[model samples]
Target: MIRQIFLALTLAAATALPVAAERIGDAARGATLFDRQCKACHQIGDGATNRVGPTLSNIFGRKAGTVAGFKYSKSITRMGADGLTWTLQTLDAYIENPKALVSGTRMNYRGMADASARADLMAFLRDYSDQPANIPESEPTARKSEPTLDPAILAIQGDPEYGAYLSSECSTCHRRDGADEGIPAITQWPPEDFVVAMHAYKSKLRPHPVMQMMASRLSNDEIAALAAYFATLE
Candidate 1:
């Protein structure tokens, strides 16, 4: 009876072990994975600066889109305004699928599909968090190349009148008053930023199904008009 009880207890402990390990993850392995998967855009550790993506040195408890000097997408900025702080669970969800969490995020990666891999990556990131004095002096990561836009398309002057007319379709999901409940707000965006983001969606680079479809149907002028209209919002 004693032996049998010991075996049962051991089995139970074994079952719990995987869950604990998954939560903690192997930070060393996560570092390697980060180099391959995230280093092209995101930087971390000591002396890390914003690259294509924001520097993620202390990202765990930080609010989204609060990184200074980086131009965040309206989606992420709205999320931050709506109280989206980065925690382990929230980061996990965002890493699993960015669009699912923030519909118009400009992160540009499809997402880490493997839960274990994401855990590892998160573990790597957590190392730098909450330790302002002791951050590791890691080398800066390479920046991802951005797609260049046509100068003419960017130079196109949009009519806010036309934009207001087209904005009805956009207002269905994005609130005109700039509230981001689930969907990100579109109001008060810079026209150039708005234009670039729409073009990204049209090219299918931004990776939201609804946005891709919506942008696919709009002409360049229409997108420019919408950008102009949304920028005027207070």
Candidate 2:
């Protein structure tokens, strides 16, 4: 009777572990999914080298933006400095929505909405983990070159007065004092980065619905105006 009780308790403990802790997901299915979705930008497995994205070899348990020779966006670098490590949970969140996890990240992925698909991708990525010693010291290629903005657009001197009027729409969600609650703070961003980010949203590359809607309606000059105004925030 005591032996049966012990077995039941052990089974219960095993069943109670989180799905990620158990590493649930079919690696075979994950491989196929990776080929379909991630093969273009990222590379993995033996002889893998960085392409548009960093090589995924030994990615699990690695610190974000710490890969040598890779020029990461400031947002991801800041998150890494804040101790964001690549784990099953973190990677899952990032893969689900790049902008949601790291606002202003230059990764152009629109995000995977299917939970099962994300799980499979995570499984495929996990296969490349725990082999840091075996990774080759290859020079990383630049991750996707940014498109050049028109000089005319970049040179547009913003009207801060007009920007102040436009800012009434933005201040509802983003705090002027830079307190980041659920939404990220936009205050004090470099004007160029702010312009680029707004353009990305306008182009449907950033994948946030509200931001896309807001940016899509703004003219290039209006975007510049907003950028200039936001940059001046203390």
lDDT of 2 by residue, 18-126 (tens): 1212343577888998898889998898989878888888787788998878889999999999999886567777887899899989889988876667767777777
Quote the positional error of residue 126 for candidate 1 in Å: 0.5
lDDT for each residue of candidate 1 in 1-234, tens digit (9 for 90 to 100): 112211222323333332211234678999999999899999998899999999998787789999999999999999999999887667878988899899999999898877668767877887887742554443112111112367688898999999999999999999998999999999988899898778766765455789879988999899999999999977
Q: What is the C-alpha lDDT of each candidate?
A: 0.76, 0.73
Stretches of model 2 off by over 4 angstroms after superposition: 1-21, 131-234
Each prediction's TM-score against the native? Answer: 0.49, 0.48
> Against the true structure, whose lDDT is highest?
1
Report how far residue 186 has shifted in candidate 2, in Å.
42
Q: Provide backbone clash counts, one per model.
A: 0, 0
Clashing residue pairs for model 2: none
